[model samples]
Target: MRPDEILIIDRDTVERCLAKQDPVALVESMLHHHAAGGTVLPAEGYLAWRNGVGAYTRAIAMLGGSDTSSGRTYGMKLINASVSNPGLGIERAGGFTVLFDPETARPTALVEAGFISAERTAAYTMSTLRVLGPAGFDEVSIVGCGTIARAHVRLLHRYFGAVRRIHVHDIDPERARRFASDVTGRFPEYTVDIHPDVHSCVSASQVLVTLTVSDEPYIEAGSLRPGTFVAHVSLDDLRPEVFEHAQAVYVDDLGLVCDNPRRILGALIRDGRVAVPGTSDAPGSGPGRAITGAYGDVLRGALPAVRPDDGFVVSNPFGMAVADVVMGRAVADLARAEGLGVMVDLLGAATRAGGAA
Candidate 1:
């Protein structure tokens, strides 16, 4: 491949490549690398504004790089979403991921990232479930019935053979029913039930996953049963009290969770209820509550796995960019091997045409 050429991997190719690879294993490996300090993760760049119709729209640019035994790779994922998208018959979030040449810092490939983003987020949930979830859980509940929730259900069906029943709820009852129908249609072995309210679904679950886009906290304390595991994927769905009362709380990254001002945990930190992990006043050290540790810590065996007696435990993944980079790199490598993407001479065209006047 020429330095001036860049591979453009469309959504179809991205999906195909991911199908042939093990996403959960990839996420686990990335988490291990992150825990070992083999990654560079910078603060995400965020921009939000109201559209012409007074609806909220936002874009996020996350940059990350990793140095592993195989090699070093860098990438960025730019995802944008609008609250009004669903009404217009479009997916709420979409974006592309750019993989850069490690040595030259130039673009190597651009892969469709919306699917990758959802898959990685779901993988995070599944990875945490392996360590923090109840053993032999036969049922699971999901709070949002959107794209992310679909990804979660798919991964759950793939990884957890014992989960035979899925309970789902959405603010829109129709959407909930549709999600249930889709799930059952695709996986005939599992039964999907739609609940009219979130609480009912939560009560029925041994493992609960919240994937809604609500900025307000509604899932209050006591919603989860004893020995339940919660994957707070949406970040803002759970009330602060839930975190305050959890038997143990684990996050993808301590600094990332505390740094984001929009999430519940960050607000708790600001209110002085939750202390930053590793500090002298953190939980178990003082009166303030503290996070147990990152899931990476658990994956590396630095932290103990959650037991049935742990009560209601929560794992909040703040969505790391390095995982996206790792997945993008994997897709790019597979695309290259199979010659799946279109190659365009990004820089050579202008140079060969003697520059435009």
Candidate 2:
């Protein structure tokens, strides 16, 4: 294969090739590897433009680390999120990932990332549950009914085998009903019900996952039951006070959180209202001290959740670049092995040969 040639894997091919547990396992290994001091993740680049109500675009770019366990590979994922896409009967988020050969610094493959993002997000949630979730739980609640929420439901059903009930809530009642119907048709073993409100949906379940796009905090403080594991997938759905009241808070990366201050927890910490985990004199002090550990630490068992009066254990993953890149690399490798995707001269002919651009 030529160094400048790129493998192009589209969304349909990725959906077809992804097995039931591929993303979950890949995300688990990457998190463990990252915490083991084998990965390098720089601060993510972010750009957002606001047009008007229900109109905006957010572009994100970040490079993930080399996968030493899988032959020194690395990648970068670029995502463009348009809030109005769904109104046009399209996916709200779309992006592409570029896998690289670390040794040569040559781009290896370009893969569609919208589906990959959902899969990785779901995988990350399940991975966190494996370490932080209460054992032998019966019910789980999800607060949003979108593509990512659907992925989460599928993963939670697969991982939380003992949970018999799934309560879902969405601002759009029709969407919620549709989500419930789809879930019921797919997984008949579990009972899928739609709740009219977030409080009822959250308070009733042992595990609560929030994926809403609410700009303001709708997850009221003191509403969640003690011992509830809340996975806040949407970065800003919960109030800072919610974190202040939680027993413990875990994020995907401290740097990512600290950098994106607009994120609920990030804002609290960045404004000095909440201190970073290791910097505090007393753990869980004030509103700013809630963030005590990262998800990687949880996976390493370095940070254990200590229940305090049945308060919530909040796990916040701000969607890492490494997760997307690693998963994309794995899917790209699979496509290569099975003779999938189109090989195109993305960089044109090699510059060394003086091929005119």
Among the numbered candidates, top TM-score falls to 1
Among all windows of 10 consecutive residues in model 1, the one with the lowest summed lDDT is: 348-357
lDDT, candidate 2, 43-129, per-residue tens: 778899975674878998888884644666688999888878767778778889999877788888889998899999998888777
Cα RMSD for predicted model 1: 3.9
lDDT of model 1 at residue 112? Answer: 91
TM-score of each: 0.94, 0.90
Candidates' C-alpha lDDT? 0.85, 0.79
- Where in model 2 is the C-alpha error above 4 Å? 51-54, 281-290, 305-309, 347-357
Which candidate ranks first by lDDT, i.e. highest? 1
Q: TM-score of predicted model 2?
A: 0.90
Number of backbone collisions per candidate = 0, 4
Candidate 2, RMSD to the unseen true structure: 4.2
